[model samples]
Target chain A: MSQDLVFGLYIFALATFVGYQVISRVPPLLHTPLMSGTNAISGISLVASLVVAGEHHDRFAAVLGFIAVTAASINVVGGFMITDRMLRMFNKKKAPALAKAGS
Target chain B: MRESLINLAYLVASVLFILCLRGLSSPEQGRRGILLGELGMLIAVVATLFKAEIVSFEWIIAGAILGSLIGTAISLKIPMTQMPERIALSHAFGGLATSLVGIAEFHRMRDMADAAATVVAVAASEHALNRLTMGSLGFEVFLGSLTFTGSLMAFGKLQGFITGAPVTWKGQNVMNFAAFAGVIGLLVYQVIFLTAAPQWMFFTMCAVGFSLGVLAVLPIGGADMPVVISLLNSYAGLAACATGFALRSNILIISGALDGSSGLLLSILMSKAMNRSFANVLFGAFGTGGGAAAALPVGQAAKGYNEATVEDAAAVLTASQSVIVVPGYGMAVSQAQHAVRDLATALEKRGTEVKYAIHPVAGRMPGHMNVLLAEANISYDALFDLEMINDDFARTDAVIVVGANDVVNPGAKTDAASPIFGMPVFNVEQARSVIVLKRSMNTGFSGVDNELFYMPNTMMVLGDAKKTLISLFGAVKGDGH
Candidate 1:
């Protein structure tokens, strides 16, 4: 493989390992929030989409990039907001602190 | 300098996202986790605007504003019960976006190839329909197109727009596999031939991929929705990763890998928790009672069970010193968590300790029951997982199984011939006195009859969970100490 391909694969492999380690420890009750949180993280693509749409000044590329930016933005904003809402409810309970104490 | 700045900012954003996952897994740290995730997204979005080529911002700004407004409205208005469907819809959008960009990029590159045909370096270069890029595009479009339809199918099933049961027909699996294989076949052909292949071939692959997505999910019963959701989640991440490859974007690659791997892990963990294989979950055509082992003779259904009145169930509850409530999808369907909570409160006032027994696959999604209970303001301490609280069932005075069937079904443990056999289930039958609140003697999604219902210690309170629990609440409170 070429140098750039090797670099990309290395990043991909290491990221997967890190992700697996991080998520394995999560409590089941946090599954929903974890999902939504990651949903927001996936929205990171909105940035590249914005650059692709604006950087080239090409008509069609701009259109595709705009739509991608829109979709990713929705995922980011709605995902994080809903997660925040759910996490708020979870935090409202004194039970979280107490439950973890026993574990 | 500019490229390095962008890369550095992306690195920072990646770190924040990592922290988000780390903190999000714990209930107590959930809020900070979301905050970090949001901050990371903000930094990444802002940094992207500084890329040297972006001369115009009108369309970008417009799209963001419109998307944000719609997204905010959805987040604000969607009921928490519908969150899973909402998530499925989000997956659909993300998948669509990625595929659209991939197609656009390929078409643009093809146009360049045509324009530069006379330039020997351009025409003869590996990039004359670059094999690496085409391979990634093939991977990206195949997954993205399928994930788009699969998630929409899931949303339809969850939202009541489609038949909630497993939709299986003759040779559905064979057909699904064929469709998927066709997409892969075309994708491979496209990779080998690059732009030499006709453009219609790629779009045709997308068409078949879409159909494959729908058929793949149709055979899956609604009961296994948690697995399906997480599996689709993994698919969405893989699609994103493939797009990252096609685009050569660092943030997309890192975050997509993170999302993809975590989703797969969650799916595997859920499958393990339920004591089923991923293959079993995918092709088992599970949750349809029509499976081979569940051939209950017509009119023989009521022979093994007896129903009890609300007072008899209440008397058992009133006499109990400790009660463990095991909830399932029926509670969510009937919206009985609040009534159940009221019943628990009344039971507690009567000097009984009440805790919930949450089987990992209790509802349509993992942690679905927790979300319902939390929405009703039930204390988190009152909820206990199967592992943490399964042993407590034997010593408890009573288990008020609220509309839960499969999770509490003893068949998972006892009947080797049963569809749910070998699947982990709550040992509700082991409790001293089992008080079951269900509408009737219906089998759960696994298509197996619950032997727990027939056990002598079990008392079936046949009615709607909310109505029954509400009455039980009244009956227990009306009986003076």
Candidate 2:
């Protein structure tokens, strides 16, 4: 394998471990937000889509890139917003004091 | 310098995403985590805009603006009760974007090979498709296509646009298997014989992957949607990872892995909560043919059961000191979270301690009940998971199961013959008194009879759960005492 591919595999392996560690510790109460949050971050594919849309490729590739960008943008924008909305609602009865205590 | 800056932004974004999940480990800091994630996304997008290769900006700008408008509207308008459908649709969007990117990359690679071949007067076959890039592209397109259609199917079921029952036919499993195998075969063929593969082979793989998605989700009953949705979440992430490989982007790989692992772990937890294997959930057609047995349990046939009126339930609630509410998918169907909150409030007014017990597989997705209850303004701190509150049921004054059945069923513990036998359930049977709010005497989505419903101490209040909760709310607060 090329060094670049090997490097990516290293990143993938280590990130997967870190993801499991972080995500597994998340309380079930926050699971819905977790799913949506990771989803929004997965829109990192937007970077690649950006290249495809503006790389001066053929019109056909550009069309595909345009649609891809639109879809990914929705996941990023909507996913994060909805996740934030949901997370904001998860509060202790004594919102100010108890939030600090609980954390 | 610009390339290094882009890479630096991505590295920072990766760390922010990690911290975002870390923040989700508690509810108190969850919103802050989401804010951090949004900032990371903003930075990554802005940096990508500075990439040297991007010569045109019109399409990107237009698509981003239009998408932002639609996304903001959706996020603002969607009620918490529709969270499952909202989540499912987002998965679909993620899938669509990843697959389209994969297709575009493949197109570019092919064009590059064609140009090189023309210059050298050689065949494109020998020049096209290095093993690693081709492998990643093939996997990306296949997984992305499947996730797109699979999530759409899940959304339809959760939204009631399609039947929640498992849709099965003769040889359904076999057909699904064949289609899945065919797609994998095409992918393998492309990877192994990279030189001789036709473009149509790749498109055919995409087509088969799309159909396989529908077939895979078709036989999964609504009761198992938590697992299905989680699995789709994982698939969407993996597709993104594959896109990263094809593009040699480290940031994409990192975020994709995080998302993929998160989804996979949730799927595993959900499946474990229901005591089912991944294979069983995917192909078991669990609720099929079980409905016939479920229909056998009707009103008043079982002598130990008490059919209580709204007055009796209200009186019971009013008399109780501590009450625990167990919500199920039924609560979501009837949109009873607000009513439930109101009842809890009334009970609290009377000095009755009210807490919510949430089973892992209680609703359409993981944390489904928590989100709905939170939207109803109930404190997350007041909600307890099965393990935390299962032992407390014995000490509670009364237990109210609203629009929930299977999770509280005692059958899961004592009856080995039961389909849900190995699953952990609430010990509501150990409470002082139990009131179950259900529509008619129908068994839950699993079609298994709940022995708890037939116990002497349990009272079945048959009606719409929302209406019943509302009436109970009135009776408790009416001051006839």
How far does residue B379 in candidate 2 sit from its true spot (Å)?
Answer: 1.6
lDDT of each: 0.80, 0.89
> A15-42, model 1: which lDDT tens digit per residue?
9999999988888877887777787788
Q: Model 2 segments beyond 4 Å from truth? A: A94-103, B121-128, B291-304
Instruction: Please tell me which predicted candidate would have the highest TM-score against the true structure.
Output: 2
> Where's the lowest-lDDT run of ten residues in candidate 2 chain A?
A94-103
Global CA lDDT of candidate 1, please?
0.80
Expressed as tens digits, the lDDT of each residue in B363-422 for candidate 1 is 787788888888777877778888899888788889989878888878778788777778
lDDT of 2 at A74: 90
- Top lDDT prediction, candidate number: 2
Per-residue lDDT, model 1, residue B84, is 81
Q: Write candidate 2's Cα lDDT for B1-481 as tens digits.
A: 9999999999998999999889899988888888888889899999999999899998899879877888899999998888889899999999999999999888888888777766863465445567788889998999999999999999998887888888888899998888878878888888887645788989998898789889889888999999999999999999999988888888999999999999999999999999999999998888746655555465335646789999999888888989999999999989999999998887776777889999999999999999999988898889999999999999998999988988988989998878888998999999999999999877778877888888888999999999999999889889555
Off by over 4 Å in 1: A55-60, A91-103, B118-125, B289-294, B297-299
